[model samples]
Target chain A: MTGALIAGIAAGLLAAVLHFAFVQSYILLGEQYETGELVHFQTPADHATEDHAAADQHDHGSHEHGDEPSVLQRNALTVGFTVLLYVAYGMLLTAGFAIASQFGRKITATEGALWGLAGFVAFQMAPGMGLAPELPGSAAADLTARQIWWWSTVVATGGGLALLAYGRSILTVVAGIVLLALPHVIGAPLLDAYYGYAPTEVGAIFSSRVLGVGLAVWVVLGWLAGRQWDRGAAA
Target chain B: MTTTTQTKTQSLLAPILGMAVIGLTVLLAVGHAQSATLHDAAHDMRHATGFPCH
Candidate 1:
């Protein structure tokens, strides 16, 4: 357990570093697009007044509005919060690995990588099928509703995958598949029409890049957690 | 034997409880965080993990 905790912290730190280096820029870019500084596309009802205000701010080269944090402050908060979030994620991953190891599976780097991929699929890809990643200015459904759907999807997919992987009986496998499909069948809430400030291409790139980075982080996390756990068990 | 069983139960329960507490804290912290800070901190993650945010 101590080893797992240590590994989780290490992985979280590493993932935080990687996120700061690679993921931050894209998100900033998306924000820019969101605020209309780099408009690639616009709808007929696009808020010209808002765009003009943003343009004025851009021309003044000042973002120091009241309650607006400075770049330094923003980046600092980003780092702190990201580290906190990833540490929690890592701990959960480690705990999960510990539980799985109790079932007699060998915990190794390779298995860890697989587990990481499974995490990515369960948490990201499966939910993404219904609720694709959104940019800052995009339209979305009610927040509470989306959150409920997202959590349910994550839980069902994770549980389903575990059953499929470990269940010995056909009944279990079927149940797993049912759980996996349950979320999509219920469906994520959607807007009556597609509406977003950013271009489709930008949203596409953002989504793909986000997932790509996530995959990398999870893989590293799993590898380290598995290695540390194994070493601790041996000791 | 009873002591051993108690130890085993505690060992199992500790990590699970720890995880639940940590997870809930993180979720609440992010859920109610300041918009911009939350966006920057979790923007990539929210997208990467398929949590909808507009």
Candidate 2:
């Protein structure tokens, strides 16, 4: 547990840095559109002509706007919160390792990374298939409904993956597959129509970048947790 | 020594599961269930981490 905490804190710091470098600018840009500080194409036809428009907007949004002060200020808290989030994720990973160890399976750093990948699949990739990383002004389904669906997806995916990883029996494997498929089959809550203040491209880039950051963070987290936990066990 | 090690392993499971529960509660609170004020404060992070957000 101590090892996981240490690793989680380290990974959290890394996550904060990665996010600041890659993801935050787009968030700021998306917010501008959300607040009407920036505007996108007025009609569907306008959207067809300028695919690069969102990228151009983001470039200026990052530089000329002189957003450095606020970005720095927000990131101070972001650093702390991000660290805490990873620490919690560490606990979950540690729990997974503990369960595996009880079954006489030893966790190596490589295996830890695989566990981290499983975490990514369960929490971000799977749910992301339906909801995605949304922008500020993006229209979403009811918050509560989204939350419910999100939780069910995480639990189902996590449990399913666990069963797949540890199950010795074909029946358990089938059950795991069923659990994995259940959430996607039920579907994520969705708005009846497409809507948002930002151009679709901005939102698209924002989401893909978010997922990318998530994968990096989770893998690092798992590796660190595994290394530390293995050290602890050996001692 | 074997008995002692088995006992240690058994005892560890409860605390590990307990920690997981707490960790999950915190994840949900900050990620999904926080109030509007907290949301405003944590806005950039909320999105950066891929929590469902407004």
DockQ for every prediction shown? 0.44, 0.69
Error of 1 at B7 (Å): 4.3
Residue A145 displacement in candidate 1 (angstroms): 0.7
User: Across residues A1-235, which tens digit of lDDT does each residue of candidate 2 receive?
Assistant: 6887898899999998888778877776777677776678657675553454446544654434464446456667778778888888998899888888888999989999999999999989998998998888788998889889988999999999999998999999999999999999999999899777887777888899999999999999999999988988899
Please give each candidate's TM-score: 0.80, 0.89
In terms of docking quality, model 2 is: medium
Residue B54's lDDT in candidate 1: 45
Estimate, for each residue in B1-54, the C-alpha lDDT of model 1 and write its tens digit. Answer: 999977986788777678757765775565434477566565555544456754
How high a TM-score does candidate 1 get? 0.80
How does each model score on lDDT? Answer: 0.69, 0.83
Among these predicted structures, which one has the highest TM-score? 2
Q: For residues A50-143, could you state the per-residue lDDT of candidate 1 as single tens digits?
A: 3443444434425444665565666566556555665666666777776776677777878877777787788778888888877666678887
Sliding window of 10 residues with minimal summed lDDT for model 2 chain A: A60-69
